[model samples]
Target: MTNSISITKIRQLMTMISLILLTLSITSIAVRGFNWGLDFTGGVVADIQTKPDVTQVLLKSHLDSALSQDVQVTAAGNEGNWQLRFNDTDLDLREALNRALLPIDSNFQVTNSSVIGPQVGLEMVEQGGLAILACFVLTLLYLSYRFEWRLALGSIAALVYDILIVLGLFAVTHIEFNLTVLAALLAVMGYSLNDSIIISDRIREVFRAKPDGETDSLLDKSIVSTLSRTLVTSGTTLVTVSALWLLGGSALEGFAIALCVGILSGTWSSISIGTLLPRCVGLEPNHYKPEETESLQSMP
Candidate 1:
């Protein structure tokens, strides 16, 4: 057997961790709910350019006091630009904001402001859900045709696992779930699938080459052989995403964070759920047996 870590032996541990995370995520979502942004729950998004002296804290306090409600204020590109999000659609709120900012800088300008209606938010939610569902179904079909039903099922399960973990983390952390975050989730799914496919193909190749080899040893060796590639790919991606998270400004913050978490979870699922589930469901040498052998054996 290869010197690679025995992922199969720790299957139970992984399952337990997944269950615990799922339970915590569900509970957090049920209790605290998501810190939905203007894109989801429907509200106003404004981009403003304030005086260089204006600070995030001062802006937030002014907006809260003027609007009589909490608002999300984050630094946008450059220094004076700021992004504001809140659940208020009244036109008067705009006037109120302008008046409130007069003390800081009479010249401050509201570059843009837009409202998202509740109905529109609902439609966006539906569309996002459909997109994820479509990805899952299509992935299953492709895998089934390319490999087998067992492998397809396993790959889908891993995908779900990756998504759930990411969702759970967001819920627990109270991160704003917005359209950008949804895009991140989809991107994560694609990356996770790529890893799963690589591992699956390697396993299939090993089966075809060494039909008489022990399944456990073959699985271990296959995973070990591909470990370098997995590490390199995932490592490089992580470095880029991490940099974005740290310095990409608030607009891309959620997107970057989502990618970072998803990459980690996806990598784990590719190794654990991707390989083990198919094995548990009865993947065998015969699944890859040469067509010529089956034809000759049947003719006798």
Candidate 2:
């Protein structure tokens, strides 16, 4: 116990860190804005396999000349594989792209094409927002039912912190926000909540075992005890996600990046924000104490 680190001792510092991150994230979102993808912005995406001579710059120039509008061209996977994204989805536009590309590489072929309409894009935006809101509400209800209101609220606070940090990085880096990224956010919520629940449960158990112990001391011990498991879990996840981000190509880049950010943020918030927020909200030993003890105390 003497050797254990006192996490509670630095609660104020952790809170300050969280507030700074939150402020930076919100401010960046306000200033830079999300780089919305075709999934949310009504556009066309085409995957083409070009000849060895084809390059992103050359393909982009050809498509730009043909379409008469700006288009994004990116390397897809192995050499000569490219992806083209445009706001226009007209049939003539598609034909024109093929014609223009033929001059560069007559054998170049469109491997895949997708078009998202304005209405569909709007619907996706609304549905994605609703999905995130639903996750938050459901998480609150479950945590409250399983433990207590304070624990539930703390978990939610940590979740918000994790999300904001991830989104903030996205804003600052200008990473594309798409359906895959949104899915990663949901996964982060679940991952962070699991860590929060484990820590909260340990704290409750500690309080029950030593009812006379200082809440701060109990919290510190609980955090220290579970520190190993948290690190192991987070480490393995980071490794896997890091590998995915490094090799998964542009298709999964946003998803992998979001997951990477989410995992790091979640781990930090679960330890700092999740545990401390409960104390700030007046959580006490009596909240988890037995009925007999409570009744005995009330006998006065």
- List all candidate RMSDs to the true structure: 2.3, 3.0
lDDT by candidate, in order shown: 0.84, 0.85
Q: Highest TM-score: which candidate?
A: 1
Q: Give candidate 2's error at residue 2 in angstroms.
A: 7.4
Query: Per-residue lDDT tens digits of candidate 1, residues 1-300?
Result: 334345557654675676677677777767777777778789988899998989988998988998888888988789999988889787575688886788788899888988889999999999999999999989988999888677777788889988887887788888889999999999999999999899888888998888777776787778888989999999999999999999986778889989998998888888877877888899876788788878988994
Q: What are the runs in model 2 whose C-alpha is more than 4 Å off?
A: 1-6, 47-83, 109-114, 297-300
Estimate TM-scores for all models. 0.91, 0.87
TM-score of 1: 0.91
Model 1 steric clash pairs: none
Clashes of each: 0, 0
For model 2, residues 39-90, the per-residue Cα lDDT tens digits are: 8888888898888778777888888888887777878888988888888777
